[model samples]
Target: MKKVVITGIGTVNSIAKNCEEFVKGLKDMKIGIDKITQFDTTDHKVKIAAEIKDFDPQKYLDKKTAKRYDRFLQLAIAASDEAIKDSGLENDGEWKENAAVIIGSGIGGFKTLYHEFHVMEKKGPKFVSPFLIPMMIADMASGVVSIKHQLKGPNFTTVSACASAVHSIISSVMLIKSGEVDVAITGGSEAVIDPMPIAAFANMTALSQRNDEPQKASRPFDKERDGFVMGEGAGVLVLESEEHAKARGAKIYGYIAGYGMTGDAYHISQTDPEGTGAARAIKNALDMAKIDPSEVDLINCHATSTPVGDKSEVRAIRNVFGKNATNPIMQSTKTLIGHSLGAAGAVELIASILESQNEFAHGMPNLDNPDEEMKDLNIPKETKNQRIDVVLKNSFGFGGHNASLIFVRD
Candidate 1:
């Protein structure tokens, strides 16, 4: 198999709009959750979300193009542009064909759907915008990114709920390892902060109701934790075969050592109670990476702060890591940035890379005192300085989809 390495990374989250800023925010333990501002949440039970504030799509894209795409696509385009430019491939004409794009989204253009429904109800079906269908499809993100960068090779979108982004990254690596592509831009984007989706999630009891304390709302792995705070943004990385990267003198950040994916046939909206499916995915990823559980320096957990979900993931981690799991410094960035859903895996992957690169460990937030049921783990209280070699990122979504990615220092 061809060796694949990460040459560039780009991210836009509730905390920051680029990788450097995002990493700095992570180190500072900045929390981005706040009352929703994108839509009226007066009648909703869940009113808080980590929204991408002060974002103007016209700044990155023309008004005409911006109007045609949804906020999710806009985020993807912005992140992809940054990744491509950071990869130093914008002017390199020779390898354009070898470049591809793979992106994922759990809920694509949800705002668009809501708006069109409102239009059909208030005015008429004929009043719906012509771009409605194209804007609402999940695959449009991949299409828009490919068209923006003139990437003509393999391109598609993955839709495994929260595992969507990890799946996309894994697929991209497979393409490069197969020698079908030399480089690929892969990640996920999501923007479902509209009233309809918010109300829907609230009705299903999947979101936090801490409207008064938005900052302290998403306390993952904590006894007081209620539910996840919704977040919107994108995370993207540039992947290239090691040989191709060396030939072009690309700066390497890390290596995509391994990836594992699994699905539980048990439920559509809940995880397996025993965590068997999630545990299997983590073990498979470790086996593929040829690394022992003791070698994992950090784990960016998929704890979404839900009552049952967070505990289930804790059990899964313990099952896979065994004794080494006792003091494994685990942190959930979701506490700071809320849950970006599909884009979460990519965002958390960036956090894992930063932790490995800087050797900075973070403690669980809002949980000044952890519960005894929260497992015996060394959850970081503040960002600590330490050397890290390997990191594992986990993303488990609705419908029992679980994905894990292993990253090693270059």
Candidate 2:
């Protein structure tokens, strides 16, 4: 079996549009959630999201290409471009022939769907653009990215809600381990911070209603937490087999030690209160890595600020680590950038990689009062400088999907 390692990473999110900015954003604990500006939210119950500011796709793509793709696809291409370039794989090479593209998106091209719906209602179905079908599908994120990069190997999209991106990463790792592909551009992108999604999530009571306090709306693990703040962004990583990367003199950021995925099977949209499946996912990842729970130095939590989800994740951690549950410093990047749905796992994993590389763990400032279950947990509210060598990241989605990954820095 081949060892899979991460060679490059890129991101475009509310707090940072690139990896450099992301590092600084994490260091400063920047809050990116605020009043929504993508549409008129005067009549909505939820009006806040972590919207990317000054996002000009033209900076990363050609004008025509940028204009033709939906926001979700644009973000995916931008981040993939950065990751490929960062990996020094932009130039022509044999790797391109067998490289895979497995980008994931929970809700892809949602903006296009929302727009085309109004186009048909106002005008006629014939008036809709011919590109509507190709542009609005969730799988297009992977298709368009493969086309842009000319990657010819396996290509597809994962659509497991919030777990979508992590599943993609896991799939990529398996492909590499099985000698199916030498390298893969895998992650997730999301751009559904539109009025329709906001209204839908709000109606379902899955969004924060603290419109007046946008910055403090994403208070994960806190007693006063409402719900997750919607965010829009992309996180892409370039992964290659250890031998393939080393042969080309590539720079390796870290190795994907192990990964695990499971289903709750308890509820359609809610995690099991006892966190049975989630604990299994974490344990499986640790077991695959051949590392004990105490070996983990940092935990990038999947706590999306939702009351049930936050409590459930803590319980899962306690269930797995037992007495050492408080040993690893756990944190949630969502507290700063909100939840980007399918992109949350990839984005949070990128945050974990940066923290491990920089030797610091970022905290959640919005956690003013942690709940009783969180009292014994080592969730710092302020960034702490410490040597971070091993990281365990978790992501759970609607539909009871749960995924966990372990990254080890050598």
Candidate 3:
């Protein structure tokens, strides 16, 4: 089997518009969650979200193209463009036939759907957009990315809720390992911070109600944590076979050492309190990496700040790491950027890679009071500069899906 490696990565999140700013944001322990400004929240309970401020898609795309694509697509394309360029991939159709695009979006074009639905209701069906279907479908993200880059190989989207992006990356790794593609652009994007989804998630008690303290609301692993803060963004990475990357003299960021995916089969929205499936996923990833639990240097947890979810993930980590439970410096990117849903996994993975490259663990600024269960774990409340090489990134989503990936520095 061929080895899969990451040649480039890019992200556009609430904390930063690009990877360079992202590094500074993480280093500064910046807080991006704040009161929602996109829509009036007079009747809404959850009033905060990590929204991209002053987002002008025209900066990354041509005017006509920017006007046609949805916000999710714009974000995906913007991030992917940076990744492709960073990887030194030619867009002149040189590698089109041997390349693939597999981007994931848990809820694609939601903003478009909501707008069009209102258009049809308020005006008329005839007034609705003819571009609604193409923009609203989840698969369009992958399709649009492939079309933009002229990548003609395997093209599809994976929609497993929050695990979507990690699953997409894992699938891309398989394709490259199987020699089905020489290069793959894989990651996820999400832009669903609209009123409807916020209202739905709020009604389900899946969001924080700390309206006054929006910046400090996403208290992952903290005793005062309520729930996750919604975030919007995209994270993209360019992956290639080890041989292919070397043949082209591409700069290798790191190796996708191993990955493990599993289903909880326990609940649709709630993860198992005991974290059985999550533990299995972590163990399997380490096993595939052929490394002992003690070898992991850092962990980017899927800690969404929900009371149950935070404890459950820590339990899973403890179960898998055993005596090394408190060894790795663990942190969650959600603490800084809120939860980006489908894009959470990929964005967090990119943050992890940055942390590893910088040799530091970003702090959890909102963690005022640590959870009792996490007392033994090495959860950094302040940025800690240290050597980091092997990192584990985990993301579990709705539908009982669990995915974990181990990345090693090249």
Candidate 4:
């Protein structure tokens, strides 16, 4: 298997409009989650989210193109463009033909779906725009990106709930390992912070109702946390075989050491109580990396701040590393960015890579009272400067999809 390295990354999230801004957001612990401004939330229980401030599609897409594509696709294009620009492979001969893209999304275009459905109900299906189908489908992000950039390799989107983006990364790694492609652009995009998802998550009791203090609402590992706050954003990464990157003199951030994917075969929306599946995924990734559990310096957890979800993830950590897993200094990115649904995996993965590269680890914010089950773990209560050698990024989604990615410092 060839060594896969992350050569470039681009992101558009509630915290920052681009990857450089995103790094500042993580370092400063600037919370992007606040009151939802995209729609009226007067009747909704959950009124907060991590939304991109003053989102302007014109910055990334033309006005004519923007009218046809949904917000999610626009975000994908912006992030992908940034990544592609950063990679600097545009001039490399035959690269576009061999490059691949495998971005993911949990809900394709929620805004388009709900709005078009209403249009159909009121104005009839015949009046629906011809672009409705392309904008509403889940896989269009990768498709449109490949077409725009003239990439002809494997192109598709993974839709495994929150694990979608990590799964996409794993797919890219496998493709590179198999000599299927030399380079791949992959990550995730999600912009579903609207009435339907909010109402649905609220009905499922999966959203935070701490509307009074939206910034502090997404308090992962805090005992007082009720549920996860919805967030919207997009994240994209440029990956390539290490040999190819070195030959082209590409800037390398970190190496994709290994990846693991698993399924709980449990409930549709509930995680496996024992967390065996999540633990299995972590162990598998470590095994592939050929690194001992003790060698891992940090754990980027998928702690969504929900009662059962947080505890289950902690138990999974215990299963693999035992009671003293805190030696790795576990932390959750959701504490600041909230959960970005399908984009959560890629967004949090970016946090992990940046923290490792910057040699810092964050404490669980707003963790005044820790959950009893997670008390044994050594979660930081404040940001600290430390050496991070290897980091594990975890993403466990609804319907039992679990993915763990290992990145080692270059």
Q: Global lDDT of each model?
A: 0.89, 0.93, 0.92, 0.88
- For residues 1-410, write the lDDT of model 2, one tens digit per residue: 99999998999999998999999999999999999999999999998999998999898788987877899999998899899999998995778899999999998998998999999999999999788888889988889888988999999999999999999999999999999999999999999999899999999999999999999999999999988999999999999999999999999999999988999999988889889999999999999999899899999999999999999999999999999999999999999999999999999999999888899999889888999999888999999999999999999998999999999985
Off by over 4 Å in 3: none
Cα lDDT tens digits for candidate 4, 1-410: 89999988888888888878877778788888889998999999889988888889888778999889998998899889888888887666588988999999999988998998889999998988889889989899998899878999999889999999999989999999899999999999999988999999999999999999998898888899899998888888999999999998898988989888999999999999889999999999989999888888899999999988988888888888874477788889888888988988888888888788888887776888898887767788888788898999999999999999899988
Residue 254 local lDDT, model 4: 85
Which candidate achieves the best lDDT against the true structure?
A: 2
For each candidate in turn, the TM-score is: 0.98, 0.99, 0.99, 0.98
Cα lDDT for residue 346, candidate 3 = 95
Per-residue lDDT, model 4, residue 53, is: 83
**Model 1 lDDT vs. the true structure?**
0.89
Give candidates' CA RMSD values in order: 1.1, 0.8, 0.9, 1.2
Q: Per-residue lDDT tens digits of candidate 3, residues 216-313?
A: 99999999999999999999999999998899889998999999999999988999999999999999999999989899999999999999999999
- Per-residue error for 8 in candidate 1, Å, reads 0.8
Candidate 4 structure lDDT:
0.88
